[model samples]
Target: MSPVEPSTAKGAATRARLLDVAARVFAEKGYGAAKFSELISESGLTKGAFYFYFPSKAALARAVIDDQERRWVAEVQQRVLAQATPTQQLADVMPAMLELLAREPGAWSVVRLVRELGADAGLADDVVKPMDAWIALVAGIIRDGQQAREFRADLDADGLATVLVGAFDGIKGLVDSTSPEDREQRLTRYTGILGDMAFAELGILAHPRDL
Candidate 1:
């Protein structure tokens, strides 16, 4: 790829900042509650500038979903699935995800919205289908583990993948209802439990001393 000019880089950075700020605001205040006027104020961008990047609130919301999927796939799913060993895969991805969510609790809101989108007929075609495709890609990684004999043949990899992702949603919900300290503590416990379950289900022997 050709090097980006300094001005281009600056423009890209500004756009990213606006997206991040908009996502946080939308998650904190529902989509309906979020205002483009406020977004411009908080982003320190003129209304024309904001419109240049995102045409409307609906467009911004779509950008938020796309941005979220890109990060999840890049940061969590791709890293784990790239590992040679399934055990290492789980270890790498699980902790990485927890760390990612810790950086932004607003992730919980995004995830919940994804689920809602999946269930709504109005959103099912446009919004939910793309989100489901991303999920299937993540789930496919688990199926690959099963095919490799790294995971139990008897267990349904697709079903397990759904459950695992669903569990994260549940944990996020729990955290949203508690204090930050308690949330981290609970998340640690949840991660441990998930790691144990994966090992047990896969019939993988834990490291000698850890067992």
Candidate 2:
């Protein structure tokens, strides 16, 4: 039989608590090293109760990843991309993401976990699906800017978006390693460079404050 969804408010709270603890555990220990006993201990839930919510470790990990991505897309990407201009949208994406990462270290942990285990576990493509969506979104914004003659039409929007995504991913590890304060500073500097490059590529004069 299929597992039942949490019915009562308390049941839903319990489930959310489990997911929260599980994300931190998986982040700290990685998928292979993370112990179910440790998770149970941290969550203050019995083995049977935990199993009722998540059948296995893999199930919990998948839930964590899905939750993190869904929240990010809804809260950050969708919200920022709703700006008046593609220029503003592009400018806002990195800073908004960095702020999210600062506030939600679990999101960073999920990213690291995916990079570490995704290939061996055959989950790499699945994990990067959200990134692909981001690329598409950025490309669409670039297309809009080009049509408005705000950005250069000669550049390939999709290719530029791919490069932008790759650069962001490459810098993520460095950001993850630093202290919280340092992470913010480094992210600001790196994203500033990104903003400058993007503006230069589009043949637009960036405001001094933007850089």
Most accurate candidate by TM-score: 2
Superposed Cα deviation of residue 158, candidate 1 (Å): 2.1
On lDDT, the candidate that comes out on top is 2
Q: Give per-residue CA lDDT, model 1, range 124-152, as digits (tens).
A: 46554444544565467666667787767
lDDT of each: 0.66, 0.76
Off by over 4 Å in 2: 1-13, 177-181, 207-211
Model 2, range 1-211, lDDT digits (tens) per residue?
A: 2333799999988887787888777766677788777887898878898889887766677677777767776787677767888788777787778788778746666766666657655666667666776688778888988998888989999999999987887777667655656766787788778778877888889852353
The TM-score of predicted model 2 comes to 0.82
Per-model TM-score versus the true fold = 0.72, 0.82
C-alpha positional error of residue 87 in candidate 2 after TM-score superposition, expressed in Å:
0.4
lDDT of 1 at 171: 68
